[model samples]
Target: MNHAATTDMADAPVLDEDPFSDENIANPYPLFERMREMGPAVFVAPHGYYAVTRHAEAGIVASDHTRFTVEGGVGMSDIRKPGAWRTRSPISEIDPPEHTRVRAALQKILSPLVVKTWKDKFAQRAEEIAEQAVARGRIDGVADITEAFVLEVFPAVLGIDVPPERIKLTGELNFNQLGPNNERVARTLRRAAPIMDWYQQVLQRDHMRPGGFAEKIYEAEDAGDFDAGTAPLHVRSFFRAGVDTTIAGIGSTLKLLSEHPEQLALVKANPTLLKSAFEEALRMESPAQVMFRTTTGEVELGGVRLRADTKVGYHMGAANRDPRQWEDPDRYDVTRQTAGVHRAFGVGAHVCIGQMISRLEAESILGALIRRVQRIEPAGEARWRPVNTLRTLDVLPLTLVAG
Candidate 1:
């Protein structure tokens, strides 16, 4: 390496912490605070990658594709390297102007009109489930509410059939694989092995429900909007990208509401605050904790010079809670206006296109439940499901006290 580059790398702060370790995964904010305190971007020695913890640096990395490209893949290990993830996401793993074309085509299929059509369906189902939960009085919010709702709705809209078990396994596997190839990845892969064929088959054209997005993708490809044989991958991307994260976000919102009755009251008193309640929950506990970007060349991030072609993780979970960007960052306040600012939905060209859909899903269910129940209270402790890149609740025990 050249002298200037070598000195820059050496000058960067090195943190010998594993963000993906079991303890950290369970409760990452503690380590995130330390990393954020260290610098804007800290070099993670064990993984040989830079960790972008602060809000500003994370935003820059997420938006500036020229400096930090997606061509090298948006995972910790470079997809260009041998033994890394073999397949790439047609939507998220490419850079413009090709990315622009792909995204436009996909957007055409999921136009606002098409998405708006799902609202009534989403609301109807959400109300039914919310009413059921209220009648029961106590529930596992994760299974009874969030998972139950998303697993049914998201796939129906995307035009795919997937068992909840496979969805969970694949969600775990995909997120874990995005980070270091640790035991978590291995365990999920093994459990998912039997369903691998089903997973692949479910996204095919024949499996698509008529008039759904998946079928529309195939039609778009036929009309020459996309390359032949790429439609299935798009459907796969849509399902994976849309489902679990929405479930996680909704699950977190419910758990948060149960924990803070006053916040629940805020939403219930002013139904207009319902949208912000979901946004605040996402800001407080982002679902997809981090996303990776590759350093296209020697770049200065948060004053730290990073090596070329290396993975840099932008921890949105950290950035969302970054004290510099937020007041009382640790507290859960439903009134917090964090939408569009929080890294939970990301930023720039690659910002989550499914964000509006996620928001709608969250609001539909949350609004229904909030209206139906007198109060949401903790029936038992909440549990987090650990995956390398995804932050989601596993179990949320709650009591829906009826008014």
Candidate 2:
């Protein structure tokens, strides 16, 4: 494999060519292919950041915190620099020692034991949605299935009393804030502005429902497991991290399976493959499309020199499909063994801590759906909703055949 081509570092594409522009965002494979072939690291001129499109480079950038620090902020735009409206994620922005403390505390409350307890809840919710869609014979996957399942169950586990309408709006704001300042960010910011105050109130310890993880965080706070006042933020962190990504992930899986009949057939025949179906979808169309890190010192990646404090964007969607790492990279294959390998949930110390919960949720929900669905045919064309840092399906229409 000739990996040594003199990569033209200066000629990389611009973000105004809008990677998230409606057309490209809906189907970004063509653009991802261009970037992956361009180099391991290519300059995204419009956003003025380097994008690591290769699987290897994405992994390196994610794991090597010394070279790429999260302190600068995890979006294409630097949240630390002046005028950025986004506040740092107490969980994602802070690196180790501090990050370790916060993450460890949350991990204990979200342990496998706690997550396993939700299996019945997720299974019941999945059955309800799957049965409805199965009865209908045709369904809009995003609205009728994926969003319904996640929005129904995620909040229940968290013990939040959020309204259904607010879920999508809140997700839009959170994910948009993770990207560069753009129309998508601006629009979602406006949409979420009115509810911002109420959003704050719901995350507080006072609002936490009894027996929920939010309540457990308060218990930890009371017991001196974490800073006295950190409980609200701790609860807020789960809402921010867990919600939209899971919706986008499960939505993408449904869209992929609908579009690829053969793959759907495979999953139906071997129900265990439902897990891999979700993994393959996460690989092909990542939920968190990019995560940023700032350089603490001068560094070089793929021969391009970067200065300290410079931001780098690792495109997980691009990395997952990098031809160097995946054979027939764009194709969705249920048996690919791609679960832990994909950067969709990220890597290293800051890798998504709630991954097991996400997996358990997806497996339980998707598993139930697969068990009932004999075939999933495309009911209509799907559309992608462009957010700054996430890739998500806005709509997915799928027709199902009952078992």
The residue ranges of model 1 lying beyond 4 angstroms of the native Cα positions read 1-10
User: Which 10-residue span in candidate 2 carries the lowest summed lDDT?
Assistant: 1-10
Tens digits of per-residue lDDT for model 2 on 197-301? 999898887787888888998898898887767778777778878988998889988888878888988887788888889889899889999888987766767
Q: Which candidate is the best by TM-score?
A: 1
TM-score for candidate 1, please give it.
0.97
Q: 284-351, model 1: which lDDT tens digit per residue? A: 88988989999887777765778887898999999999999999999999898989999999999999
TM-score on alpha carbons, each prediction? 0.97, 0.93
Which candidate gets the maximum lDDT versus the true structure? 1
Estimate candidate 1's alpha-carbon lDDT, on a 0 to 1 scale: 0.88
